[model samples]
Target chain A: MPYLPTAQSFLEQSRLLISARPTTTRITTKYTLPKTSPPDPSKSKSPPPPSSEPSQPHQPQPPKATLTLKTYDPISGTCLKYETDKAAEVGRLIAALGSCGRVMAALPAKEEAVDEGAMEVDAPVKEDAEGKAKAVPKEKELKGGQGQGQHKGGEKGGGGGGGGKKKKGKK
Target chain B: MATGHLSTDEFLIRLATLFESRRSVNHGSVFLTQKRLSPHDLPKAATDTPLPPSSPFPDLHPPHPLPILIRATNGKSKDKRKDKIKLSTVIQADELEGFFMRYADVCKAGMSGLKKRDRSGRKAKGKAKKKKGASGGGVEGEKKG
Candidate 1:
């Protein structure tokens, strides 16, 4: 009876061992070996790291598009095509014409060149010349300088002589 | 009338606004003359917008209210200051409106494309990182147990 029990237990243990051995082998064969293998060098390599240097600052670039306009051709009596890269230039031109008109109006037409030249001269000189012109009448009353006195003398001669003639006729 | 004193920034702003208005009215190209506005009057003539009184650069011309010709392709000089005076570069009103509209549309399209590209790139990167993490965790768990 003892021998029989020992034989039965041994057979059961052998069966269990056989089953367990396969499962352990299967797990090891499937997972362990594949993982342990060296990673392919090509797969492991990554692209080069991004450059660490600071990037250049971006600047506001000019617009690439061009704008064109049609202007009157005085000689041809037809419109001619003109182009400008900027929009502001046109506005400025209009404004300039307006100012030119004002300049043309304020000064005598014959002295336009002289006035333009004077405007270009030093500001102090222009102020001084204006001041001298302003003082001309006042200086005439006190000192009677040639340019100022001549005008005053002519006025007095015309008025005073007329009054003397009237007084003589009354006497 | 005093445009000569107009600052470049003021001139530009005016030029932009002018272009916008002209565009609305179906005006053709805008032409800029060689004569520049006085820098002083540019701020007022260009726009109705008021600037901050306390600004440090108050002396500078306020932004322009109208669009201006900034560049001319056929002009002899590329320098803005020098080229502006040349008649060859002045663009007609109708041409300017067309150019601005086209430019704005192109810019809008480019911006949208960039946004879409950025979103797609982020999604792809996130998926790759998640896959890598899952694989790493599975390996670690098996080794520990």
Candidate 2:
């Protein structure tokens, strides 16, 4: 099995989000969610991998809420929900969220983003501001010179493709 | 201008390499289950071995602790002895970011507490510097008089 991205990477990339909101155990940096998501619980729960190594001991199954990390295709309407509890595996998804260039979606989050049954909304979802207005804050934040060097790296990771752009186009 | 997009496959590859270079904090308990033996779990075989299967797995918050169950699927095998069948250690996930995030408050509290102490030390230093400045001013006044 491929080893997970080191604890340091996740620690570095998403440290702000994690430290900024200590109570939040799970956070989704959705590049884009459709305007009328109508979130489905069944679809969200990732299918466990086949029981190949039943003899292996101490293979704990991930609990429901802290378990899923999905990326939905706006065009095909497919959701790629990851299932492994491996720090390396799930950590990749978590790190991806930090690295992803999350532009504001045209639509705001609904009361029911996903039927994550016991998944508590750890913090209030930020209200979607007008398109251009949202840009102002990001630009000002860029001016503050916080991790501006990483911005170049963002181009290589996320800025190259427009996952959010595609999702927004469909909505 | 910041512009790029992440395809899922691409992101996975980048996570393996780019993110690996940075330094991470030690949460201490992560190494406990990291190199654990998943195979050779049969109790008959295990009891003969020295190390007992990992007994104490860490508890999780937003709590996603997967149970470590060692299934005994032998037909007509009704062995009730606890030593005959060993259960798995109760831990989950390959990556530990979630684990760290779960205990972030503890780490944050420690970091902020250190910053506060550092600030107090700086204030004390500033006070000493001011005292020296006052003595210099007194020497200058004597010369003027």
Candidate 3:
């Protein structure tokens, strides 16, 4: 199976919508009518058999609701859709998306737009507003900025940018 | 760096990549929206006609159906107006839950938490640098004596 795209790419290029379909229950009942015989002069009236009795009574079956996640890249007009009846999977996606939403909300509006090539090494040397803001902190860190060395050292493996920043601090 | 604790930009960028990767494969769980011939593509008479009542597979008809768009087999060009199509992306529940767990910590703390952590980390680095500077000065003095 192909591994999922890393989280970085998802945040940069897509918007998502989540929706739930309610469960529905189906119950069926069938009734059978009594068979009537034509009355004849020679035949005495036969006792009427019970009529309109239910022939089949089925128990109600309720199907669980399905949860759907729709992710689309507005720029490219491409979409990827996923759906599942499993509750566990639904919950996870909801939680992850919720967290992402919260973080986005907390961010400054100015940093919201990221340059397409900012993360790529060969894309271009141009830096956007967000990039310029990030550069200020790196400059301070270079001049004996705060934070533990060992802790930051351990983080070198966490992300490419983090690793590169630490190396500059050391120099 | 915490396994799931990433700054806002990093987190979002990574997520976009993850979504792109998921789109590469189409299976039971992940469905890439497909383009099928739109009703407009059919002749006027065909568009007006409904399915015959005696159709064999009644169950195949859904009460509510998803919109379909035409697929381009070769490099057929698209007509913006005539080819208007609707698209949807559906992710299976299991995968959604799996992702939630993977990024649980970051999601729980949110961006503020990361910023707080970054502040504390900076303080720690400063202290460490001071200690290193003191020890280095001592070593140089000892060598001169």
Candidate 4:
């Protein structure tokens, strides 16, 4: 059986999560639906193991992929499980739910920086500086002069270190 | 849960209508996650393959993809008390690929529609040509010519 999520149900959702792996891809949506009956036991608790276990009763079974759509409403407390292997059905549900909002990739910031570093080891982050230099050539010259002045001030501060070194030597 | 599936056209229409209705509210977010397989967790056959002889860092270019686990939370400041819903279903790679492609198109359509609506709203507000610099000068210059 295929799970047909309604437009109203889609609007009622607070969060939607789609996990895509090489072998298995899962689409899960959490709805803050209005509570009707006493919450279903399966809603708060983990899914029953029996539901998953009964599917594979035979031995020497080959690796066969199955699409399972599990809808759990927190209010109703009823967890509906639908299983299908049809590509068309799975694609349709994904397309429908996916359109509700934008799909932002869950990539970590640190790993992306590391990946960029590994790929472009020699490339320096000078694009912004170069672009500013090109657009405002006068500003670049002013900045260079300011940098030189700061360097000269630092050199004078280094000369003052001699008096401090003499006091340390006396101590 | 509805038992019967909707046609592709009807499904898109319903989604668009829902989106239009929910545009004003802070209805929360939806995102996609993709996991990359790490070399260590890969199958023995994939690990057995040799790297290219010309490369310096052979370890960097592993034949097997890296295993990356991506966790998606609601927002930057996650609520500790609220129960985060976790649900996942397993499907084949080919079907998943098709979904991603279609999802991209859907997002593009949704974004373009929103942009069009925003432009119309701005026009209604009479905020056109609020600029006072080069753009304004250019308009005056063209009129004089």
Q: Please give the range of 10 consecutive residues that has the lowest summed lDDT in model 2 chain A.
A: A99-108
Top-lDDT candidate index = 4
What's the distance in Å from true for residue A77, model 2? 37
Name the better of 2 and 4 by DockQ: 4
lDDT (0-100) at residue A37 of candidate 2? 26
User: What C-alpha lDDT, on a 0 to 100 scale, does residue B34 get in candidate 2?
Assistant: 13
Query: Candidate 1 chain A, which ten residues in sequence have the lowest lDDT sum?
Result: A24-33
* Residue-wise C-alpha lDDT for candidate 2, range B68-94, written one tens digit per residue: 211111011256433231111212233
Considering only chain B, report the TM-score of each candidate against the true chain B: 0.30, 0.30, 0.23, 0.33
The TM-score of predicted model 3 comes to 0.21
How accurately is candidate 3 docked according to DockQ? 0.02
lDDT of 4: 0.36
* TM score of chain A per candidate: 0.20, 0.22, 0.28, 0.24
- Give the worst 10-residue stretch by lDDT in candidate 4 chain B: B85-94
Off by over 4 Å in 2: A1-171, B1-103, B109-116
Candidate 1 per-residue lDDT over residues A1-171, each given as its tens digit: 012123123222222221222111100000000122334656767643345313432223222233333322232333323333333333322222222222211221121233233332222232232233465435423442454567678999998898677556643
What DockQ, on C-alphas, does every prediction get?
A: 0.01, 0.01, 0.02, 0.02
Segments of candidate 4 deviating more than 4 angstroms: A1-171, B1-32, B41-82, B87-97, B105-117, B121-145
Calculate the i-RMS of every candidate, to one decimal place: 34.7, 19.7, 21.9, 14.9
